[model samples]
Target: MDTSSTPRSAVVLGAGIAGLAMARVLHDFFDAVVLVEPHPLPADDRPRGGVPQAHHIHGLTARGLDLMEELFPGLDRELEDAGTPRLDHGRDVLTCFPTGNAPRVDTDLGSRLSSRALMEARIRGRVLALPNVEPRTGLRVTGLVTDAARSAVRAVATDDGGTVPGDLVVDTTGRFSRLPRRLADAGFPTPPTRTIDAGVGYASGLFEAPDQSWLALIQPTVCPDRTRGAYIGKLEGSRWMVTLVGACGDHPPADQEGFRAFADRLDNPVVAAFLAEARPVSPLHRYVRTENHRTDYHRMPAWPDRFLVAGDAVCAFNPLYGQGIGVALEQALLLRSLLAARTGRSTPSGPVGVAGVAELTGLAREFQRRLPRTTGYAWRMSTFQDAIWARHRAGRTTRRDRAVTWYLDRLYRAAAADPATAATFARVFQRAAPPTALLGPRVLLRILRGG
Candidate 1:
């Protein structure tokens, strides 16, 4: 154990899933970990103002579930014991993508269906149990305090005129993070931002799960032709989470009849059929701010040492893709790996060297530089679809990438009719494989011959 190399403390902003995960990761490297939240966290899986989308349907992708299980062993068992519905990606979900319905078959990919609030609560519970972790509630982070040179963050300034000092600060404050503003105020250049707004929105509600063999149903709309979609899935407490989505000026209605009518108008009537017979347990909750945004902190000419941003603060994708939590989990995993390498504590024998600002500066820069690579694929997939609708709505022709687009259309059609193709594409959609897998010789041959 190299106590001299270990940092005294680490501070994390935002007590959501990302924040909690950050705290847990920091616990392995720092002597003390403090998690600050603006609101008091509930002990149970109840809706909170901080996360409006919590009312909507949410699930962990296969990769996300795997990461959670790695970070918190027995996580799947814990959720199952709590009555959460487990979904075998290929067997349990009936998906109707714009291409076609994915064939039903056996798959090794795993997913869990539950409310975001519940997942957050479970993860937070594990983080709070760590002896070195402290959860501070009802305190807003007003700004980050820097040293005289403003080269590194030394502490977090709270709204109550107080400060929490730490050797490292990780900002998981989500899409509305103010770290950029703080940096600008401190005479530092803010990271450049990129956004692709499809003008999409969602209206969600909780209802009793329909009597069906499948655990979930999805009917997504095709671009240019249709702009509405629906999803109905089982959640804990024997209830179902239903979300109706509309894009590019086709917003869903919040009223009972309108919501039902909207669902009925999806590409398929699966969601509408379930809503027809299901009993509503909650009001229609609407969320309109669905946009893909990214802060390019990695490209900044100069970033303060010991300050890092992850989760939604770094990249927020279109919620329709179900990649937010998954991306956040991957980001946390990346951070852990980065920290492990710098500390030389490869098997957790004991605490590694205390990382001073000088030691962490290079790591921070490297992390930001490499962070985009991790999110690039998901961003491309989600934004590509959104851009299709965006161009269609604007009466502009889609930019032609003849080889790629033509090949994908062919592949999608093949997947609808071929079980093997469906499973292969499913892996890409679930992020189990890289997009290049579709370019393999055999798959390309099938598409070339119009299989």
Candidate 2:
């Protein structure tokens, strides 16, 4: 492995967080990296066609913030300068957990609140600044170019009648990617698929936040009878993005009055209060196109060389968990490490060397392994908590449910009073730290002692 050798070239599909992050990491290992996006990405804080969920509220968990900082230093400051609200999770925002109605003690590990569109715009600007990276918008990727043997993909075809060849191709095309279909048409067997439809629906609209007040509250009410949840997140420019979600056939209505009524029914009053006081900045945007879907690409009997899929294209979680962006960032970090490990090794000049292809394939496989543990946890948590609401709706009461709810209630109350408990809970909620930390001996003792 010679460190002085010219780096490889790579192409990334989509310009969303995952795609942009992939391109950013690829720039470090490749002499030329091109990002293909189908929509014209804006230079300022406006919505793009590619990300339909742009109007929705987005926040980085403490762990995600740390990873982003490691990937691009000063991103936090950049976001702050752009008017993103930096929230101390324990102190600034109040969260009501399902375990109990007692408010959790707030801690200091803060989260950044902003619109998904704003964050995407900022990251895109930084990514485009790299000399070795090129982003070409409005070019749709129609298919992949594979060798006659069909064991590997060599290039990607675009609707513009042009081809972009690369040593590696990473798909960050989000949940709507047609790569699996294209691959199946190319004689490749479709990867195994899994779907869990909680029948969730979302309706979001931007509204003006009160002056001098930071609106970073998330009140997730679990209603067993109706199976519904709602969230309110503060965004930049003094606006707030509120979403009303329903599950198991309780879809949120799209109209103005219907939407507000749904918010009024949530266990938490925060969303309804904001809706009554704030003026709407945008029309209600509704999303319910896909359930939680994931493909086991790594477990495939065979895969094309020089091809890998990342981001939502690989596994899309229930957005209510707010894990999509964080997971994507972690994937990019992993991909960067894989490339760095392969740096000095011999590679096939004509196409990705067989060994090089194997390495990349392994990287994609590792992502698959990690997805279940990540998304699966959130999926189960959401459904399980929803089940409690369902039980309440059914007018069923059980000693077990009561006990669990009691413990959770005490935990939240303690969190609101004890900064240590609050910070620990925030870390777990952000997915930046493990949930087991909350069950530690000291924490458990406090919970038993009723804080």
What TM-score goes with each of the models? 0.93, 0.83
Q: In terms of lDDT, which candidate is strongest?
A: 1
What TM-score would you give candidate 1 relative to the actual structure?
Answer: 0.93
Candidate 2, position 95, lDDT: 64
For residues 1-451, what per-residue lDDT tens digits would candidate 1 score against the true structure? 1144655788999888888887878888777888988888888777655997788899888888988887778878989998998887788888776667878877887889998888888888888888888888889988888889887888989999999888888999998788789888877897899888788998999887556878988766556566888877899889888888888879999988988777666747566567668988889999988889899998889888888899888998888788888777778878888888877666442333356544465767777788887788889878877876666667764456334446667877777777777777778878898878777776777787885
Q: After superposition, how far is residue 359 of candidate 1 from its true place, in Å?
A: 4.2
- Highest TM-score against the true fold, candidate: 1
| Alpha-carbon lDDT of model 1 | 0.80
The models' CA-based lDDT, in order, is: 0.80, 0.73
Predicted structure 2, TM vs. truth: 0.83
- What's model 2's lDDT at 74? 91
CA shift at 144, candidate 2, in angstroms?
1.6
Q: Which stretches of model 2 miss by more than 4 angstroms?
A: 1-7, 97-106, 211-214, 267-272, 344-423, 438-451
